[model samples]
Target chain A: MQKMMQQVVCTVDVVLLTLQDSALKVALLKRGRAPFKDVQALPGGYIHPDTDADTRDAALRMLAQKTAIQPPYLEQLATFSGPARDPRGWSISVVYYALVPFDVIGQAGQADVTLASVDKLPRLSFDHRAIVNTAVQRLRGKSQYSSLPCYLAGEAFTLPQLQRIYEALMGEALNKVSFRRKMVEMDMLEAIAGEFSAAGAHRPAQLYRLKPELRDQLTLIARGL
Target chain B: MQKMMQQVVCTVDVVLLTLQDSALKVALLKRGRAPFKDVQALPGGYIHPDTDADTRDAALRMLAQKTAIQPPYLEQLATFSGPARDPRGWSISVVYYALVPFDVIGQAGQADVTLASVDKLPRLSFDHRAIVNTAVQRLRGKSQYSSLPCYLAGEAFTLPQLQRIYEALMGEALNKVSFRRKMVEMDMLEAIAGEFSAAGAHRPAQLYRLKPELRDQLTLIARGL
Candidate 1:
């Protein structure tokens, strides 16, 4: 007698996010087949067996294949599963959220890289809308108490640039003085030894990079802080 | 010409959690049949076709069926998908983290309510261990800035009881004064205007319940606080 085994299908989805024109934008791909054909959706694909380290790596591979973009920062977002989420059957998707510097993704300039405002994105396919909504909420929430927003900013950035990313993500303005104080108190930022070079801005403000040691500490602090 | 329809199989797993004797315990059920027969695992099953709300609803349904307990609070933890996560074929599990009052679970007292501590849990079957680990990390992370630990407390609880739950989940000790101050600042707790009748070694402390409005606020805060 042979024993029957239960089979399940898994997939990974990527929500590639970038800051463009002071607005947060997400990378979306147009589905090409039935099930939510021709609808705008996040870049995703099946969980390949040999090419990736984990679900996150699978998401990166899918993103690279579909959009020719390799996001610099990726984090696991919540997963979505519903009996009817897929018209097909019981499929579960592990969603990963990625933050790419505007210049990096903007450099790709693929037609699929739509720059819709985070607040006013098009109707996404499947439960993609809910997945994106939760990712945005997590991004905003972590930004309040961690150095995560720094990943969304360029390698080196002015305090205001960092603040703007927070504002864009949170959909609200923050007091510069208070925000700076909070950052300093967290001790996650390091002054880059001098002021910014005279560029296209008001007065050249000081530049800073996130302290490396602080990421793990922030990970722990962000857990319950 | 034939149009192709893509179908995927999905499942829901619940990592039901409660505080027992000042330690974090996860609810696991014994697998009765193959894949991993008779092995301990998180209580879960396939999403029923009829009357299932979503993956989350399906997880709740499974929990109810297995443990005869209904979690008042359930949140999507993450989706687990790997080509080989299941022995049969490609499978994905939509995992959910549930917080139920210890007293409520104790009241149910179902014969199968196997409460295993995070530190010394039995060898869990499948990727259920990984799923539970992920949920535990997420729970500790959320407990820091959210009022999540309060949910583990019974109807009425003392500050010390609440503090102990936080300590157990985070695996760290906190100063009582600072913890109280932080909780008060959040404005999510309302004092019950009385003291605990069952006194322990320490002085009988004041009791508090979560404010109703705070539930909505907590959902927001738990995302990243």
Candidate 2:
């Protein structure tokens, strides 16, 4: 019993996601050590009880260390565990998924991390493929009624740009009128006063940003888009 | 690093919830060992990687062993971990929440376990109070647009009985028309042929059961009740 009890392995993994070129992408880093060395996977590390405050702090630290990007929106996704998942004995990985704007990834100037489309992901280390799929499913599911897509849309955007973001995540074109109505019902966005999108052949559209209080939180509608 | 890695405590906790007397209640058991012995908390145990297939298996074993009740619906909630949450050492608990009918609890008839109303919970060990609150919030949130409430209603029930269960969880009186419409949109329930509620002051209503295939799955609607 003592031997088995002491064999439990604990770690935290972060699935840092972003939207790039109208497709969802995830940041991956090649493992430096064995058990899948040089293979790309989610940014993760062991929990340092001596210094880390909690699993969230450990996740944030690992993300910054590996990818050089701090996500604007982050939430606990789920935990994946078993004896067979890790080459080492029984293991538990407390997984978290974060959303960052495409520009944020670019600004990080991380040459070590690779941005891969979620749909066409390569063979990833451990059970990372499944983790990425779960995050994608959650993002798509929450996009129906929550202001989660706004994180991928960046700090400020026009109604048309936000609509395209939502449509891309949901995999379907939405009725513009109903989409706008649902957005209003969520009440999590505010017009950026005196700011508008650059004028093209058509007239400029008013810009909007998530409510200051709701930047770190999600606002959900009673119904979906 | 080796010592800290070996010191991580891994465990599984189950939040077994049921609707009793129109109120949500959680099953709790008193600890038998040190570090808060005799204090009531959620049923949990160490993950036995040698025998248990996964954390979910550990959760089910703990629930059955401690409370003698196996829930019909079980879902992973989230992982709670930190250095302070446990006195023994840095710990990781892969928490799962389960839904069972009130009659299921009665059938188990375990005197060692106590069913406490979630609204008026007593002092619990570890971070169990917060765990129960998270499970309750999840139950109430999913009840808005999924067939999750059906598990609390038992194997078969009339529409009105089901609606009452939904109202109990949501803490709101839903419009009859919209509620029924949303149920139909979910398409997860099927009427039990020739089954009806006993005639009382009001006429008997048709009895329905979650579709056989959906017994272990949830059917979701785009919009809420």
Q: Tens-digit lDDT track for model 2 on B1-225?
A: 567776777889999999998999999988889778999999997899888888999999998888888888999999888888889887888999999999998899998889999999988999999999999999999998889999999889998899999999999998988888888888898999999999689899999999999999998876677
Please write out the lDDT profile of model 2 over residues A1-225, one tens digit for every residue. Answer: 457667777789999888887899999998889889999999997888787888899999998888888888989999888888888777888899999999998889988889999999988988899999999999999988889999998889999999999998999999999889988988899999999999789899999999999989998877677
**lDDT of model 1 at position B144:** 70
Per-model TM values vs. the true structure: 0.82, 0.97
How high is the lDDT of residue B8 in model 1? Answer: 31
Worst 10 residues of 1 chain A by lDDT: A1-10
Give the per-residue lDDT of model 1 (tens digit) for B100-144: 888888788898778999878799888888888888888887777
Write the residue-wise lDDT of candidate 1 on A113-141 in tens digits.
56566789898888888888888887877
TM-score of chain A of 2: 0.97
